[model samples]
Target: MKEVLVLGAGYAGLKAVRNLQKEVGDNAHITLVDMNDYHYEATELHEVAAGSVDKNKITYPIKDVLNNKVKFIQDEVVKVDADKKTVELKNSGQLRYDYCVLALGFVSETFGIKGALDNALQMTDIDQAVAIHEHIVETMKKYRETQDKEYLNIVVCGAGFTGIELAGALVDERPKYAKLAGVDESEISITIVEAATKLLPMFSENLANYGVSLVKSLGVKIMTGCMIKEIQDGRVMYATQDNEELQAVPGKTIIWTTGVSGSPVMGESGFKERRGRVIVNDNLLDPDHDDLYIIGDVSALMDKATDRPYPTTAQIATRMGAYVGHAIAQRLKGEVPEPFSYNSLGTVASVGNTHAFGLVGKKEYKGFPASFVKKMIMNKSLADIGGAKELFAKGRFDLYH
Candidate 1:
């Protein structure tokens, strides 16, 4: 039997393992490795960070979705030697494989900014998301003792999709923070700072404006065209076009949601990469190594239309995973698989639990209707990867609320 190794248990790697088990049958021995044993919904991390949802609501055991045909290992990956078809694990030592899938997920990108890494709270994983919520609660308690206004301030750096969603979630949970601080909800302030003047470029101008307006209506202050210079322990320094002098936003809870890059293991593995992503071929294979397939955030597939790699998203990652699984099965059958292609069905940004905006195909949705569709989309993804068990247990069925 051929030995197959898949890294990371995110949307990409997990989906790949599920599909590979069914497609390849007894033809291959599949080994799946990840640092964590449970798979959490990456999209709902903001909710966790904002304390709007429990971490358990969005995570499920990895073994719950796996069959006996696939072996699962909970260990961190150290590096991948594609030329030798070997992977070095932190504790499990080296493992050789006939075929390997590199679907390692992303990490928060600090952009080499001073104090960004050491200062700001990140929402990349379960622990980090929970930590953000804990910090917010602690800050509220601190405000009660110290009576410092800075403790009531929350500053989010970035207006990108993740940043915007997080801001919305924070707004939804403002009342909780207010209660903790023994202050009115309005006393708690939430601010979002972005370098770009224009926000939500992914949506149509009208839709983006509607989304922004919805967030602003919640009393969140958004400062655009503010380039973040550095992150201090309790402040964020930025410079705006109107005034080149650095201005500081004082906040006890500073969130770093600027952006994310693929796993650093890509670079440690000696792959020719940019920003932790490998430029894979049409077949999603390393250009020089046929046995190696790189998918998810770690793989960059250029879009001929845009002359740039498609933006990394859970939607694209799942597609890449499913494709790789089927492609490998076909290869085992002595058949060549077709090149990968993508067509996005839609993109949605939720202002909160009850508000959202996005385009489905050529039609745009906003307000409560958009929120409903967003939940459905999330449920669909849960079913696709985790099946009926997870869908019923951890699914977002709160449509009317």
Candidate 2:
């Protein structure tokens, strides 16, 4: 039997393993390695940070999810030597592979702003969410003791989906938190800062406006076209729209959601990059190598129709994984593999517990109907990856409340 090694147990990696097992039948051995032993729903991370959902709801044990079909190894991949077809692990020693799949995902992009890395909290993983939750609790405790309004201020660094969602969730939950901490609701402040001219730049103009209106109605401040220059210990320096001059805003909590770039593994692996992402061929395989393939956020797939890279979303990554899995199985059977093509179904973002905005096909939706659809999409994704039992155990079915 041939040995196939997969790196990262994210959406792409797990999907690839499933497809490979089905396509290759009993002739191949699949091994998956990841730094952490759990798979997390990266999209719902903001909800976890805002205390809307438990952190465990977004995470699942890798072994419990994959079972016997795929062998799960909990270890960090330190380096990959493509020339030798070997991967060096942090603890399990080196492993040689007949074929390799890279699905390492992405890392947070700091954009080199001063005090950004040190002062701002980021929503990246389950651990980060837990940290944010604890920080919020502590901040609230201090606010009650000191009666300082700045302690209640939260300045989000972006107006994109993640930033907007976090801001909206914070606004909805802030009142409850203030009551719990014995603070007045008027003391709480939540602001969203966007460097772009408008919010949700990827969504349609009407949908973006709707999202802004919904968030503002919930008392979240939306500051567009504001470029952040610095983030001091308890303040942020940014340029407002009226003038290009920089101004300072005091806030105890700063959340950075500007954007994300390709995983650091791509740079370490000696791959040529454009904006921290590796350039891959049409088949989602590295152009310079035949036996190695890249998927998820690490590889850039161009859309011939638009002359730009496909958006980095779970939908696209899952499709890429399935394609790569089948392609690899064909190669192992001494047959040619087809090239990879992406069909973007749509995009969706949640504003609050009962509000959302989505673009499916040519239709645009908003409010409760859109929120219901978005929740369904999230539940379906969980069910697809880990089945009904896992979804239920992870509280994915609790979207009704």
Candidate 3:
């Protein structure tokens, strides 16, 4: 039987395994490896960080969705020797594969900024998200004891989609923090520090402005056009264009949401990559090796229309997974699958649970209506990953709230 080794049980890898197993059946044996036994929704991590939703609400066990044809191994992937067709795991020794899928996911990118990785909290996974919440809670306790206002201040060091959503979620949780600190909600400040003057480039200026305004109206402070210089302990140092002198904002909770790069395994495995992302060919195969297929955040597939790579998102990752699954199955049957293609459905950004904005099929949605659509989109993604069982279990049914 063909030994198909799939690395990482993320959206892309898990989806590909499910599709391939269903098609290949007993013809091939699939081995799935991941460090964690459970899969969490990467998109909704902001909610987890803000304590708006429990981590369990967005995570489910990997074994819950695996079938009999696939063997699931919970372990960290160390390296992949593409030339030798072998993968090294932290605890499981080494494994050989006839075909390999690299869907290792992303990591926090510090962009070589000094003190960023050391001082700022990054929300890349479940543990980090929970850490942010715990840090905030502990900061509140410190505020109650010392009555330090900085303990109640939150400085988000990015205004991108993740940073904006996180600021909004923090706003939603401010009341709880206020109660913990024995202060009014207004005393707990949430600030977004953005380097770029223009924010939310994903949507039209009007719509993006609307989203920003909504977050700001909720008492979140947004300081755009301020380039971050460095992250210091309990402070964010930045320099604005108007004044090159370094200015500082003191806060107990400092979050780094500037950006992310693909898993380090790509570079360690000798794959040609930029910022841990490999630019895959039309077939989503590594330019140097046909046996190796890359997807999700690790693979950068160019959009011929815009002459730029498609932004790595859950939507595109799922599409990549489904495509690879079907393609591999066809190859196993001695047939060729068509080249991969993609057309995005739309993009949505949620500010807190009740406010959202986005474009779907060229239709602009905002306010509570957009929020409903956003939740539906999230539910749809969960359904695609885990089907009816997980969708009902961890799905977002609080659409009306």
- lDDT, residue 369, candidate 2: 87
Q: Residue by residue across 1-401, what tens digits does model 2's lDDT show?
A: 88899998788887888788778867778899999988998888898888888888788887776646688888988788889999999899999898999998877778899998898887777888778878887888888898887888888988878898898778768887798568777678888878888667678888888988988888888888789998888887898667777887788888889888877777887888765677789988888888888998888988899888987888888888888888999998999987887788788888768888889888898988888888887887787666677778874445556
Better of 2 and 3 by lDDT: 3
The lDDT leader among the candidates is 1
For each candidate, the alpha-carbon lDDT, in order, equals 0.93, 0.83, 0.92
- Candidate 3 lDDT over 1-401, as tens digits, reads 89888898889998998898889857788999999999889999999999999999989998888888889999999999999999999999999998899999999988988889989999999999999999999999999899889999999999999999999899888999999999999999999999998888888999988988998999999999989999999989999988999999999999999999999999999888999999999999998888889999999999999999999999999999999998989989999989999999999999998998989989999999999999999999889888889999877788654
TM-score of each: 0.99, 0.96, 0.99
| Candidate ranking (lDDT, best to worst) | 1, 3, 2
RMSD per model, one decimal: 0.8, 1.6, 0.9
Off by over 4 Å in 1: none
Give the lDDT of residue 364 in candidate 2.
91
Question: Model 2, residue 230: displacement in angstroms?
Answer: 1.4
Who is ahead in lDDT, 1 or 3? 1
